[model samples]
Target: MDGQLMAFTGVAAGMVAMPGADFAVVVRNALDTRKAGVATAFGVAGGLLVHTALAVAGLAAVLVAVPVVFETVQLLGGAYLLYLGAGALIAVARHRSAATAPSAGARGEVPGPRPTVRLGTAQYLRQGFFTNALNPKAPVLFLSLLPQFVPAGQPALPRTLLLATIVVGMAAVWFPAVALLVDRLGVWLRRPRVSRALEATTGVLLTALGGVLLAELVLT
Candidate 1:
């Protein structure tokens, strides 16, 4: 149990820091609107809760039953990570361009469809719920990787819930800090060259993570 907890914590920590669809969406929403940042974060986290539950229930079993499918998931996850990393890099590059800079708008003015029109307290709640729910990786991650931590013949539900809770809670804590940090470092982060570099680095990390996951699947 101790080992499981520690491992889960490490994974959770990594996930919280890593940029994903959830991270991008939440950060965009938070930065774009008033107090919507909190709402967005919560929305993403809420989505995680649903994913966690489904993963713990029977999804993990399905993955374990068909190892090939599991491998496919790992490959797909890696690809997804790469895609996100590339997107961030592209955003950074585009923002750097003189043509795009004016259109980038001040601080929060990237023109597009806003995540929400309501902008009420409820909007925040809904944002948290939907962002997490819609994220496919959240469930796949829990189902694919978490079972490795379970002990043989042990009832998995309790452990799964615990792991999921840790992940979600950690995300709740870490992502807000991220929002603040990103917001604080807005100028530096938004700097086209710097943003591009960071995005590239993150992209590399994602690809590496994918490689690692694939390797693990192969070894098993």
Candidate 2:
């Protein structure tokens, strides 16, 4: 069992390292505020808990077996991403407009650094949670991955739970590590031009990913 767990750990590590929409969300938020990034990172971990529960309770199989259920998850996931992406792009436009618009600076008053949205902790956490929870891929991965790791002739529940916990633990560590690294670079990332450019790019990437999900659902 130790050897099996070791192998599973390696596989989990690889999966955690793979950049996905979760990584994008973390980076995007982290670039804005370190605390937001950290909160988002753990919120994703919390999402893994949701998947773990579904997988453990064997609802994931139901999700997979029912085409309607799977499609609904896909639809929701795609729509959520699209919503976030559109929001980011809209923020960029508004910020740019604000920068150029006539303001008190036009008079003798000195202008302050342009105001930007600073999401509260709970809101950031929700952003992170929904970003991961809505994605069908995590549930699918949990459902498939855990069973493979459980050794033959062993009680499945305990082993499955342990393995799921491992995946969640890795996510807890890995995503936050990413957020911290990005935070360390906050000095430069917070700069207006660089920040806005990255924000716009992340937005486009998210929107494209969402589109791909919807397209795949259609094609499938």
Maximum-TM-score candidate: 2
Measured with C-alpha atoms, the lDDT of residue 202 in candidate 2 is 80
lDDT measured at residue 57 in model 1 versus the true structure, 0 to 100: 81
For candidate 2, the per-residue lDDT at 33 reads: 78
lDDT of 1 by residue, 54-171 (tens): 7878765676567676667666655554554555456545544643455455655544321223467676667556545644346667788778877788888887778888878987
lDDT string, candidate 2, 100-211, tens digits? 6677448655433335689899988999999889998777888888999888999999999898889899999999999999889877877767778878888898899899
Q: After superposition, how far is residue 160 of candidate 2 from its true place, in Å?
A: 0.8
Q: Stretches of candidate 1 above 4 Å error?
A: 59-118, 183-220
Name the TM-score of candidate 2. 0.90
Estimated TM-score per prediction?
0.57, 0.90
Tell me how far candidate 1 lies from the true structure as C-alpha RMSD in angstroms. 7.4
> Against the correct fold, how does model 1 do in TM-score?
0.57
Each candidate's lDDT (Cα)? 0.62, 0.87
Q: Which candidate is the best by lDDT?
A: 2
Model 2 lDDT, residue 217, Cα: 98
